[model samples]
Target: MAAPTSEPGTFAVTYRWGLPLDEAAIAAVSELTCHLLKGCSPGSSCGCKVNRNLTRLVRQGVEMEMPDPTLIYSEGRTGLPMADMWLAMVNPYRLTSPSRVYSPDFRRPRVQQWP
Candidate 1:
């Protein structure tokens, strides 16, 4: 799912992983989504810095096969620290405007849940 944005060059991308995910999987994918929001440019090759760095980070940081959905829930939460180590990595493009990362209500589809 994606939220509407008025910016011409910006976009919103949401990954709806059905519930039952452990905290670690949620964290990994959330981090991945944040990298995507930081601007994976169109026509980017596999060598795109965003792609390369995020992949490496996931591999080293998580060290697990990306898990499949394991449980179901009405609501959950996820945190993305835009000002933390994520920003320490190289992002050649600008941050996607109006970017937000959170756990959505799987039962309600695109409805976002608050902390």
Candidate 2:
């Protein structure tokens, strides 16, 4: 959990994986998480504040994952239920889709040096 920012009552959740996950996979997961929290169907074309604010936030920093503001109060929608549901069955390893068997960018082994 991150410290509250200049935005009133706003905070961020940060994650650092030991293995650097693929950027595309991370993005898919992030968007799915956002939509789930906003009570919006995945891939829905809703012009809701949740989507708009999230897009802006992600654009600002792709390295950081941004929570859907609408789930809190940005869109006047309380997402407590959705949040609870998520927490009850959260799986960090869950993927939106199967990853490639091998990719130079995501699957390359890291070089290590012995002390």
Candidate 3:
């Protein structure tokens, strides 16, 4: 698959894996997520930072058919990452925003209260 065209420094370094993710994959992904979170701005929410980076990694992994352990971690935290990645990759220009959907700005009407 073609290398991601996004700007450099937007994502973390690529991780190489001998095979698809296993239990070890979980540990690796968590470690990488922590590392990525460390670099985010102090005011930035940890959950958001983790999710964004992980989502990018997973999307790349699925398309390439080689799951990077780091990206796999994102999937472990929230299964949606892998599925979201697949959808995003298929429709690169799609405007769908997970953040707005999952964690909406409270200023707006709280529609369909979440459990």
Candidate 4:
């Protein structure tokens, strides 16, 4: 697998295998990303944080196998249920907008003098 290249605030995670990723693998990647983000310091960019940890996981013995959903269920196995559900919930709300913009309005302050 190729190493991930990320900018200061942006990260790109790529799966190098020619095959599509399975749900379990996707879930694992998601978990890994979250773990990294949680450890990031305040004011650190999230993308960079996630990418760093993902690189570690990929380096580890985690297989990039893409398992079939049907096969997983056929054996009456609940395979990575929590991650799957969390992904389902988070996917829809993933990128509605860019980062929040805060505006500042500066005006002369009104002072009341004692009568």
Candidate 5:
């Protein structure tokens, strides 16, 4: 874990496992992003704020790798700070948003305990 956000369960982690980085692997990575975005306390003030473009790309039925070398993106509460760091490192010249995204304007997903 690089650094944890204000949320107790959220952290900025860099997973650099050595592999061929195939299309299947990229799909799995994208799915992991989805999981992290969906993993949040329901009805809590700290919820996930997902990127609609990413979701749309996922829904498009096309399999392609993300261009950025950062590999992972954290838009929700779990990885907001990390996301900022990512943007700064990747594109420091570009104007980026701040930490005003703590509360997602949408409802969060409810995860149930397994039997």
Candidate 6:
């Protein structure tokens, strides 16, 4: 099992494969993560924080083979039970999709490196 390493102010959610991904969802998360990571201003819409380590910006949802997961928080309005249901099942390769994928910028609190 992946141990929880959520920072005190960080929001987190799991992303599993074979799930439907919405463009709006992706945009919303990308903005949130980038803003929270201090990459961009609250007034500006910066894309998801780029994981300079991986040399790519983390998106709303990732592929199954993605080894590291980003931060994901549930939207207050949309009560998608998808995460709960997904957590119950047995899927080892599941990808954790937090509402916002943490910025991969080295200075941020949650940066990931591929093993």
Q: Which candidate's TM-score is highest?
A: 4
> Model 3 Cα RMSD, Å?
23.6
lDDT of 3 by residue, 1-115 (tens): 2446485545546778776765545555666566567657686654444434232333645643434456555543333354445544545665445434454554766689779
| Candidate 2 lDDT tens digits, 48-70 | 53345442334444556545665
- Report, for every candidate in turn, its global Cα lDDT versus the true structure: 0.45, 0.53, 0.51, 0.56, 0.50, 0.45
Candidate 4 vs candidate 5: which has greater TM-score?
4
**TM-score against native, each model:** 0.22, 0.21, 0.20, 0.23, 0.22, 0.21
Clashing pairs in 4: none
- Report the lDDT tens digits of candidate 5 across residue range 1-115: 4445766777665787776765544555565566565656455343344333442235468765433322334322223444445545545665455435556777778999999
How well is each residue in 54-76 modelled by candidate 6, as lDDT tens digits? 43455677533322323233322
Alpha-carbon runs more than 4 Å astray in model 6: 1-18, 39-115
Off by over 4 Å in 1: 1-19, 40-115
Best by lDDT: 4
Candidate 1's residue-wise lDDT over 3-85, tens digit each?
A: 34766666767787867866555666677676665557677553325222122234445763421222111112122344333
**Model 4, total clashes:** 0
Ranking by lDDT: 4, 2, 3, 5, 6, 1
Tell me the tens digit of each residue's lDDT in model 4 across 1-115. Answer: 3544654655676677767878766776777567567658677664433322121224366655545555654644334556556555556454545667555775657999999
Better of 1 and 2 by TM-score: 1
What is the Cα-based TM-score of model 6?
Answer: 0.21
